[model samples]
Target chain A: MRALSGKVAIVGVAESDQIGRVPDKPAIMLHAEAARSALAEAGLTKDDVDGLFTAGISTTELGEYLGIQPKVTDNTSVGGSSFVIHVGHAATAIATGRCQVALVTHGESGRSRVGMPPRVTPPDSLRGQFEAPFGLPQPVGAYALACSRHMYEFGTTKEQLAEIAVATRKWAMLNPKAYLRDPITIEDVLNSRPICWPFNLLDCCLVTDAGGAFVMTSLERARDLRQHPIVVLGFGESHTHAMISQMPSYTSFAARQSGKVAFEMAGVTHDEIDLAMIYDSFTYTVLLSLEELGFCGKGEGGAFVSGQRTAPGGAFPMNTNGGGLSYTHPGMYGVFAVIEAVRQLRHDYLDQGIRQVPDASIALVHGTGGVLSSAGTAILARY
Target chain B: MSGYKKPLPKPDPVTAPFWESLKKHAMKIQRCNDTGKFFFYPRGLSPFTLSDNISWESVSGRGVVHAFTIVYQNRDPAFAEDVPYVVAIVELEEGVRLMSNLVGVEPDPGHVWIGMPVEIVYDDVTEEITLPRFRPVRAT
Candidate 1:
């Protein structure tokens, strides 16, 4: 457990100059812009970054685009959760001297599809053969299935689910950049038009153009950097199934395994989790993840999130960036979550004018990829 | 098929038997004889074991609605006309699960609930493929 704990730290984090719009830049251009900003923030130039990690594109392509010949590169695309796992990878790589500095970047043109290739699956693939035949719309279709089962098993009400959206909207209202900052009510959510039966348009996350990047280096090097280092205490990742049909249990997440490992390594419990930057591709994703991450008992997510507990001034502050529900959400929302966690820990979120959490020393940032099929958890603290 | 532009299952060598059985109006599941567990979406090896010794057997074609959703919109052009269609996962008595659609009932909050018993019905979409759907079982 001590092998990588506190050995590495995230020295800098940044987002593209333009987000929430179909940017003038291409996908690779976004990656470059974010990477350069992160480098500038860390007081390092391209030459200092020896490790490159990315998703939706190869690190080789990114290296060539950024003109950085990384000593180590990882292209671990596990959906939205890829970047958090990259931290664990970066920490281990730096500890082993594989690289001195690691830069992880994520950029997607979800709304504009600018320079992105069409996503196609062969007919015989797991998704094509079973899940696709029914013409299921993702990530809603797959997640709604799990929610329906959770409702059956636990009597989770649509009202309880709407509470999540309501709470998130309250947080969104505090952030000027949130795509939908207008305050929302549970009634409004219920009245919203349904995209998928169990999920209203409000329940689904916003589709926007965005990119985020961060740099990780050994703790020794981080002390000398201009930015305050957010120490990486623990990280864990797990996955059991890809397709919903193959998933062993609807209410469970592979995050249970990953969260346990992360918390144990960090030596922190739920009460000590100062801020939670959970991926909110949809409201259910947050609720289910809260339960899976051990914040609340299984089947108690509805009650746990009620009364806007995660909203401003609530007991727990989650998705302070307003989350994918209101904040700009590219195809992969994980990188943005990590960026927010870092900002909160640095007491730098005031740039958005939102009140900072009093004690942001310890944070739990959990990311889900592929419809809850994969989860990677990171425990970051400001040392 | 009402000019549906949604992707259809193109039965490959491994999954031909599953599609062929659907055409016969029968529900077939791959039973890993060694593990004594049933699996779906026809595969060569058991998910638990590497053993390819399997049997394709017909089940009762009756199961409980494990979960379901009514999709109001979709990405594909084939499903443009399929607004408010029901996508469901049914858990068969054989302990395996299959994803299909719900038929013969209204798709609404009051009508649909999890754990409702359902029986399989076939919708002959094309000459080669028959789409299996489920309807709520009438309390006998």
Candidate 2:
């Protein structure tokens, strides 16, 4: 797995409507707004983007709205990890001169929107008549089952899981864009009303009506751009299916394969990663990714995340911009992870005291989609 | 107000067997004839071999609990009354893990140990359907 190192760089990243219930806006609008914001951030206009990549939003629809005729377009929707996976394709497109600039964006009004299509249930074609009639309905309950298994197998206490929520809140306090900035404790997470067992309300991520986007360009084009170029060092992706039952292993994510591929491509180990922005749709997800990504040995993730090690100014500062848990989780959370990584590398948000890893050179961003069904891993660095 | 009713899941093509078999007080799994592999949530073909050589086979429903959790909260609104229910992943003698409710015991997280022996019991939910649940097997 050769890394796509130094071939492409994320020149700009931006988001739209971080908080509040926004039901009136359609999904495509969020995508367009985020795309415009990223272009503005990069000092480039919509006319400059030649390649358009998006997930969970219609590529042609977004392109039509942006008024750009893209030479290369990808709409690979592998759930939340789709955006991260597109980075690899974007890199390859840029490396071969298929396009000068590629923009990947995602947006959703999951909380406020209505008339959205129900999740796909295989083996039966009827609408809401197949799998939903059975026990597995929403993703929250399905993920809760996995969380319960983690607690049962490794003796992972609720407090240990709550540590993730508590730490993310500390970062969210600094981020004004965050939805839930109120300070919380482990007891608060434990005592919150249980949506599903082992997972109280606070254990889950915030449902946001937001959109995120990032602009990528070839190394040559990035050198001439306005800001310090954060190179796309490596990228990899893997997907299984939407159904929870189909997942090969409940505890270990498919991302382990992609993480290995990405790390191998970057020519770096877990120790070389100065910062990480692993998706935190649920607390168990982060814990599982830690084990799968080789950050710690299997069954040691519970012990690894202890003592606020992932908190601000801790051993490994992760999800520094509050992540999907405390920040915004408008449908797909993959693009937001990339946004945080690029921001941290560029030292753009330092005035807010969010930059903990000073001179941070290497960073990893990972994304999960479906019910832990698909995963994408990427490594970014300041060269 | 409507009278209290246990909201049992409606049987569909995939789960019709598990529900229908409960009417006969039996536990079964869809086993592939060619490869002799077993699967849950019944399907038309074997997942591994993708062969249409699959049929329903009855088992003793005797197995060990691979993993168990005492859920203090219920996700379904109908099961609100049954708070703190025990759910376990039972590994059948045929070597497949299935998710089902554990009954005939107290909901103690510590008491439900992994790899503990367990057996099936069919609880009649409807005239046409019976739900297959599990309970701890008494040590001889």
lDDT top scorer: 1
Displacement of the residue A83 alpha carbon in candidate 1, Å? 0.8
Give the candidate number with the greatest TM-score: 1
Clashing pairs in 1: B5-B78, B6-B78
Report the lDDT tens digits of candidate 2 across residue range A1-383.
46357789999898875444667787777787888888888888888999999977578978888898999999999888889998888998998889999999888877887424564444333213223333432566567667767776778888888889888888888888888899999899999986656678888888888888999998778888887889988988987656664455677878888899899888888998989998898898899888888999888888888888888888989998888899889777999999889988888766766455677889999999888989899999985
**Model 2 spans > 4 angstroms off:** A1-3, A118-137, A354-356, B1-23, B53-55, B68-88, B105-113, B123-129, B138-140
Model 1 chain A weakest lDDT span, ten residues long: A349-358
Task: Name the runs in model 1 displaced over 4 angstroms.
Answer: A350-354, B1-4
* Model 2, docking class: acceptable
Taking the tens digit of each residue's C-alpha lDDT, what string does model 1 give over B43-135?
888876979989899988999988888888886777878788888889999988888899888877568888889999998877767888899
Residue A25 displacement in candidate 2 (angstroms): 2.4
Q: Cα deviation of B10 in candidate 2 (Å)?
A: 7.6
